[model samples]
Target: MVRVLFAGTPEAAVPSLRKLAHDTEHFDVVAVLTRPDAPAGRGRKLMPSPVKQAALELGLPVMECDPSEETFLAALKATGAEAGAVVAYGRLLKEPVLDALPLGWYNLHFSLLPQWRGAAPVQRAIWAGESLTGASVFRIIKGMDEGPVLAQSTVEIGAHENAGELLERLAQDGANLLAASLQGMAEGQIQPVEQPQGAYEVAAKITHDDARMHFNVPAFALDRQIRACTPNPGAWCQLHEAADALEPIQLHVAKAVVAGADDESAPHGLKPGELKVTKHHVWVGTATDALELLVVKAQGKKQMGAAEWARGAHLTEGAFCD
Candidate 1:
């Protein structure tokens, strides 16, 4: 059995940890590594990472430290770990640490090798309207996700699937792939292949400014943007009214679809960024077509049906979104 050191921090990595720990026939998880406790929730209390919580429940040892620390290598060696399995550990492993694992370390990245190889793979893939994407198990090299691939599994992306939804699906599917890859490697049934060299785009982390919805873009583009940012940093736009005499109100848009003849409200003919609120629906104009908002949240308010919030705000005819 392979003595594995598993490193991860988020809920997405929980299944991989469980997979290795439960499969006693092929693996023994010596310890789990994760980032230190972080401030979370409304009260800002320091909370253990999901991986740490899961590790304790599994009765496994947990190490909260970064790879760059001088003592990290010694602490890792003390666990008697021969190999490492990493998933979203949020740091780079280098030099002595990588060499300490005689069998080498493997990382599970949420994108096909050589594509979307960075922090926000799932979000960037959906934002770019990629029709298909996958997970890869690769050797952890010095550069960011620039290692040879050991295994990969592909999945199709739904037209309207948000980043959060797609990531949830990948997290579960990728767990099975990671376990199988490790098993295959031990049995000498798998080999690593170098990634193709080319000018591929990297998946940089998305910021609040990057999540803002620009109405001047086409409706389809805006639709993708909103879906990509859903449930995190969330897609937002500003509401500007001619007579408000105040700064524009920020609105978080959760769901929307491009307007078509088949839509309930047909041919809005509204100017770009113009917002029209009716009894049951809210539509915002875009470069190519109108977008019907299904859900939204006003600043400092709970998320609700777009029309419900619009009714309370009493937006004037000239109110627009930017």
Candidate 2:
């Protein structure tokens, strides 16, 4: 049996941690290290991390440690774990912990490394108009997500996949990949491959400022940005609810694609932020192209089809959307 130390702290990390918790025959998960619970939701209640919840349910010792501190180092070393596995732990592990694990620590990152290395991979990937993104299991090194990869798998970037949906799909795929990587590690068949050097893009963690969509952007860019932030912040644009009354409307651009550019000199004369509604969907005009909005939510309203929003709300064609 291989003694494993697992460090994780979110819903994204829960699947892999649950996998380890059930595999008592193959993996002796001596301790589960996770971040402390913090305020969450509308009431701002302190919520336990999924890993912490799962670890306690399984009767395993759970350690809430500051990732930057050495708070759990002694307890971690006491486990006699030769290996450590991390998934979305939300903090960088220090050199001492890495050195303590003889077999080395492995990280299951959401992106295909050297690109989207930071906290927000899926959201940033979509926001950056990336055609594809994948998962990677790499040996933890000093640099951020610059470690050599043990295994990787790719998935197509669906035309209008939102960050939340994409993350759910990737979580399952990553769980499978992590299992395979662990098997290879035990058999000594897994070899870390060096990361390539190139003009890689960084997926900086998405912020409140990022959720603010600039309607002046090309339709394609605005569409991607909307899809990227959907189900969380929901793409928003400031619009007038009535005369002299500016209301910020949050619309979920649930579907989109590259459109309208037939040639280099194609004509796009539509005024940006111009809104149009079809029988089935709502189309928002952008600087370069037009985006088809699928789901939309007005202030004090539930999310629904764009056509529904058009029907319920008295939206006019000449109405301005900032």
Candidate 3:
């Protein structure tokens, strides 16, 4: 059995850590490395990361320290780990730390490497409307996700799946792949392949501005944006009332769908950002087609059906979103 050191944070990484711990035959998880507890929730009390919580529950020793510290290498070596597995640890490991273990470290990334190789791979893929995305187990190198892949598997993106939902599925599937890859390495049955040379787009972290919805774009693009930002810095737009009595209210779009021609609720010849409310649905115009707003949250209000919110707001005829 290979003595393995696992490093991760957040709920998404819990499955991977649990997988390695439960597979006692091929691996022995010596210790877990994770970030220190930080403020969370409404009261801002210090709380341990999901990985840290899981490690404690599993009766495994846990280390909470930044990987860049000078003592990190010594601490890592003392764990007697021959190899390491990282899953969204949220820190870059330098050269000395990389060489601390004899068998080297591997990372379970959410995207197919040489593409979406950055902090927000899953979000970027969904935002870009990628039909296909996958998980990769790659040997860690000096650069960011610029490593050779040991194993990989492809997955199709669901038509209406948001980033949060897709990530939940990927986390579970990636856990199995990660465990298999480590097991194969221990048995000398798998070989790492050098990544193909190419200039691929980076999945840079998405900001609040990046999540803002612009109705002037095509309906499909708007749909992707809304889905990409569903449960994070949610997709928002400025609700412009007919009279500028108050500043534009922020509206968070929870769900939306492109208005098909057969839908009787969809208004015809609506200009961009134009709002049309029927008894059952609320429709907004985009560049190419209208979008049926299913759920939305107005400023200082709970999320509700778009038509319900429209009725409660008493919006004027020219009221719209931008």
Candidate 4:
């Protein structure tokens, strides 16, 4: 059996851990590494990482660290690991730690390397309207995702896919692909291909700022941004009005479609950034077209269909989004 070390964090990494633990004939996972527990939610209570919770259930040893700590490097070496496997580990490994393992570390990245090669590949791919996206098993290099590819598997992104939905699917798909890569490695059939030079773009991690909708851009771009950050820092904009200090009414738009149809309510001459809200919908004029919001969540409320919120929202017409 191979003594493998698993390093990852977040719920997306849970399925991979479960697969490794339960499918023990193929691996001897000596240690699981994850980020340290941090305060979360209402009471600021401490919460363990999903990887940590899964490791504990399997009765496996787990190490929580900031990844930059010297102690963490020693912990990694203590595992006496033959190889290290990572999936969404959320931190870069130091050189000493990488040298400790026999065959070097491998990463289960969410995008086809040399494409979206940074923190938010999955979201960037979807938001940029990529029809195809996949996971890669690559040998880790010092540079950002600039590693030789060992193996990869592609999946089709749907026209209406949301980031949350796509991530859930990729998490499961990644497990199957990583397991297969390990098998190939064991058979001495693994081959690493150098990534193409100067042909990639960084996927800056999605932030609350990235989620804010800027209708001044093309409608297509705005539509992509909305789907890419959904169910999290959901793509948002201001609605008609606010009560306190002109508090910008935060609107979390979930589902949207680009439309060009001209009905009586469509704001024609009002340029981009203009918002049209009625009892059933909120449409924002964009550079090329108008984006019709189907589902939305107003500030301080649950997510509801745009029509449902609009009925009670009383959003004023011609309330331009700031």
**Model 2: CA > 4 A from native:** 246-270, 277-281
Task: Indicate the TM-score of model 4.
Answer: 0.91
Span of ten consecutive residues with least summed lDDT in model 1: 260-269
Could you give the candidate ranking by lDDT, starting with the highest? 3, 1, 4, 2
Compose the digit string of candidate 4's lDDT tens values, residues 95-196: 787777887888888998889999998889988889999999888878888889889999999888988889889999999888778767876888788998
Candidates 1 and 3: which is better by TM-score?
A: 1
Model 2 is weakest, by summed lDDT over 10 consecutive residues, at 258-267
- From the highest TM-score down, the ranking of the candidates is 1, 3, 4, 2
Task: Show model 4 residue runs off by greater than 4 Å.
Answer: 242-245, 260-271
Worst 10 residues of 3 by lDDT: 240-249
lDDT of 2 by residue, 91-180 (tens): 788898788888889999999887888888999888887878899999999989888999999998877788988888888889878867
Q: Between which residue pairs do clashes occur in model 1?
A: none
**Candidate 3, 1-322: lDDT as tens digits:** 9999999998989999999999998899999999999999879999999999999999999999788988888888899999999999988999889988999999999999889999889889999999999999999999889898999988999999998888888999999999999989878999999999889989998889988888898999999999888788899999986745478999999899998879776787888999888778889898988999999999999999998998998888888888
- Candidate 1 TM-score versus the reference: 0.97
C-alpha lDDT score of every prediction, in listed order: 0.90, 0.78, 0.92, 0.83
Candidate 1: where is the Cα deviation over 4 Å? 241-243
Deviation in Å, model 1, residue 123 alpha carbon: 0.6
